[model samples]
Target: MEPPAPGAGPDRPGPHDGDPGAGRIWLARAALLGGVLVPLVAAGLRGVLWVLLGVAGLALTGAGLWWTLAHTGAVRACGAALAVAAPLTVLGLYATHGMLGPAVASLALVLLAVAAAGRVLSPRSRAGGAAPAPATAPRHPWILMNPHSGGGKVGRFHLVERARAAGARVTVLTGRQDVTALARRAVAEGADLLAVAGGDGTQALVAEVAHENDLPFVVIPAGTRNHFALDLGLDREDPAAALEALTDGVERRVDLGFAGDRVFVNNASFGTYAAVVGNPGYRGAQLRTALHDLPELLTGERTPRLRMRSGHRRAQGLQAVLVSNNPYRYAVGPGRGHRGSLDSGLLGVLCVHVDNTVQAARTAGGRKGGLTRLTGTEVTVDADAATVPVGIDGEHVMLPVPVVCRIVPGALRVRVPRGRGAPRGSRPSADWHRVLHLARRSGPVWHHRPHTTGG
Candidate 1:
């Protein structure tokens, strides 16, 4: 099969896709080797000892992270202190050794080399890359704009005027109105296309109506954090840019994640986060509210111990969980925290289970660490209580126990302008194994093929 389009596959196009010749691959491998050697040669055995100290500091930081979940305020404060002290302590030790500048510079070089190697050597995903269908202008397009969202992003961007000029009907959600009702009314009034300019939660409500009616849906980044729009590669800074999709657009089918009966365009967060968001002070000040609320939730009389199951795999006593429509692809750099593809037809599950400092230290970089990542068609999360709290795409709600999360493949048809472009590809995690494979292979390999998961 052909490599999937840039935005439709886990391994989207990176810099190497254009020209991945053997010479470049060999150069990348050499750079990675050189990077490792430079640190060893410069730091020497003594430097290695210092680096070990740094790693110990990382372990202390991990201990701090785990302590933040403690019920005692003093313990949480101490944990925060350890997290802050780790790097400062490392810098001080280097300064005392009089090799601070050289060591830091060498570390930076090592990082650059690793990034380059990862970009070139890592394999791209080849699943769910089907070409999006071509689309024409809708006769009656309707928009539901939330004035309060994103600090009045709709009014600030003049979206209503521009959309009206483009011959689309627009309705302003004045206050506490039902978005689902407004979306349905628009469809009943002959809206061939449905769109929303609000948070992901509001978008999900309208999207469900659009999906059921077989209409195209457009998203505007008018939320506090436009997670869905960012993944779609829409210009979050310029909310108006999304309107172009109405008049000049193409169609791409993407899946929606479900927590019980509610649909979410993004991931569903449970346990600690769900409780934090439910606090009355959360919307006013998130960090402060979470700090105030965490002690009780973490040390409550009846802590909510979660049990998660997917297929034959099972995990218990997780503190929190994030379940998404498709697995998110993360890089070591900037501007890429979105999913690799929304049509992967599987639920990406992340279970965080850290009972103590040791587990926290052991589970630092995810998988086998405290944070467990997996993918399956369905996942069930249950607690000791009859009902559980959930944060679905930033909206707080309570779901019945044994809450089932599932992926609805091709459940939403999205429209974007033909001029739409993807965000910069995320750099994959460093893979020494892939680098070695490149060195051993006889011929140049620059194509993508299918793999199950964990790529």
Candidate 2:
């Protein structure tokens, strides 16, 4: 079948798409724009009057301290004292000058501006143009749910009954069963649609079977962080709403990342992150373990020797490597974790090779210090060791040397609810260029004249 045009689909129209809520959305956008610009103008006026000197001093000091901490794995007592003292000194100075309130408000406005910018610039749903699936519900729909996932979401939400009500056979996955085998059996049993309500890892396994058998796949967001579901424009907060897809849904072809035989719905990570997740204690205390291991992973000489080759370029001694199924937008604001388009049929590769804490600090500061980011259809990584630790959609495993990662374009038919609209956090923030253009045109000093061709 031919692919649908971008933003042209049989899916339900969004609130901003000629719906009654379009007016309200426009009003909100206007408010957000005002909120972003008003404060910036006010701050600029203050800066012109030299009233922002104190704020500038405070900001610079904070940035310096943050840079210091990033460069040094361990903070010295003197450095810690300085970090505290610099902020206090700024506060005290502002308080003495009776400018504390204005300074605080300025800072708050800056934050609001950043948030508004994100909301305005975030990309709209690419799924808008996807073709509609069959209006009739699947006759033999099989849903494999993990009861333990998302703290027993299946039981809490009565997903089995809900699935049954939607004409689906529900199977609760326990520790004893294999998800891949279960999916295969469901296919053999003549299941028309394969669905899963679990984490991305489990969902990926079932999705692989569905893709291989040329069956439509439905995703129920019952995971703690349903990155795949979010990308599919499903309601992550409400798993029950996803059941609507089985009956009324749109079929979208999305790209999937593969590392050898294993498939991942989100991303396949290597180097530091993969090693950290491979630790036995990581699942229980993820943050603590990551924090404890990061210094060693970043600083120690015993770091794993990782080398990557994508196309004609090659990189080595990387601290971390993230191979996303689709390219993720990295900007200095919110809405950074989402993909612009999932069917782009390309892998997003980010390799980090920070030699020292200072370089790491600069890299974190967006200086591109020892960081290599590119897009390709395939990537091959070879580690010094015989086996390399890999993190596939948050699940850790040990894979053999020379791990090959590639993007499988349009390999999976993802079904999402017709009324789901755009997924949360998928919308792009306002375009600064457009905003500026409008601003310049609206100015009292600017005017335009119509031109005629020998009329």
Candidate 3:
């Protein structure tokens, strides 16, 4: 069978490309020599050289990790390595010298070097401030901005001027208005592209309308930690550049998650966590409550009795349940916080069996309760009670006890800014660059066209 895309397959060969069998043989031999024979030989020689070697090893590991975030691939590969090596180096030095003086000095120097290099190479902080957004195509695009998104990024970022200047017609929506109605109206009026600037919940609503109308959608990230947009590589700070791509960028058909009658771009969850977020002040007090009242939440009588059945598997009396459309559950590395990829179709189900106080604390990134990973097209969460508070795409929803969710493949079309041109012989990917170029040439929409037909 043909291998999947680079990110699609977990075991695909990456930058460490070589014959796997041969590489393993060499690696095993190297480990044997360095770990067993060399160490034994050095001990027999009764030399003080291990201290210097250990220090050098720690310094090198610290340097690699300190730079990994800048190099995404390296971050994936060696993020855990550096985290482990730094501690081991420190421990070894302490064993030898009984003081962290030399080890601390070396680690600091290496970290400083890494920090300096990061600052020097960071493009976002360059001296020229920020350049004018490059131009794009002349397509007639309509925009819907939520002023409440990401602490009001739309109003703060000058996104409208940039987008209008890049050949898009802009509209801002304030207050509790219906975005779906606005989006559907735009589609009916023959708007070629419709982009929404807001959180994932708002994105899901726009996507539902776009999907129903079979219209192309553009994502202008204006949410706190816009995970989907970031994964798609759209510039969060530059709406003009993203808008230019919509006028001239490449379009990709992405999936959307369907939960009963609702749709979402991310995941959904139930239980105490959902109840917490549904509360008026969940976002502001999540960390605080998670720390203080967790004991009561875990051991209290208020625990909702939930019964979950996904595919053929079943669980009972669950305290908290999280059903994700595309698993964003991932950790930076081993023993790290949970993290996940957004593109994978499988939902990550994390159930917390919080029957006792200790178990509840462990559920909050603690050491007691563990997570479960499953693959299913449809998930059902049922409870004995009548109404249950559901958190869908970071927004609360009031629904009946049982809730069902499934993945809708290729349900939405989104225009994203393509990277630089492809190499010779490779087919062109997203045409973002070309789109931007064309939009720039078309110039801004100086006047609104006269309304005709149904518009």
Q: Number of the top candidate by TM-score? A: 1
Q: Native-vs-model 2 lDDT?
A: 0.70
Worst 10 residues of 2 by lDDT: 446-455
For 134-185, candidate 3 gives per-residue lDDT tens digits of 3344367888887778997887888877777776777788778888888888
lDDT, residue 138, candidate 2: 81
Go through the candidates in order and give each one's C-alpha lDDT.
Answer: 0.76, 0.70, 0.57
**TM-score-sorted candidate list, best first:** 1, 2, 3
lDDT of 2 at 101: 65
For residues 1-455, could you state the per-residue lDDT of candidate 2 as single tens digits?
95543333455334334533223334444544554445346455543343445434444454445434333444634444655676677678667756566556655544444344444333333233445454456899999999999988988999999999888998988786989999999999999999999999899899999989988899999989888888777777899999998888877778888998899988999888898888789988987777666656766744477898887778898877898997665533564476656777878888888665456445444355677777788889888888787898988888897999998889998888887835433554333333343333322111111111100
The true-versus-predicted C-alpha distance at residue 16 of model 1, in Å, is 14
- lDDT of prediction 3: 0.57
Worst 10 residues of 3 by lDDT: 421-430
Clashes of each: 3, 11, 18
Best by lDDT: 1
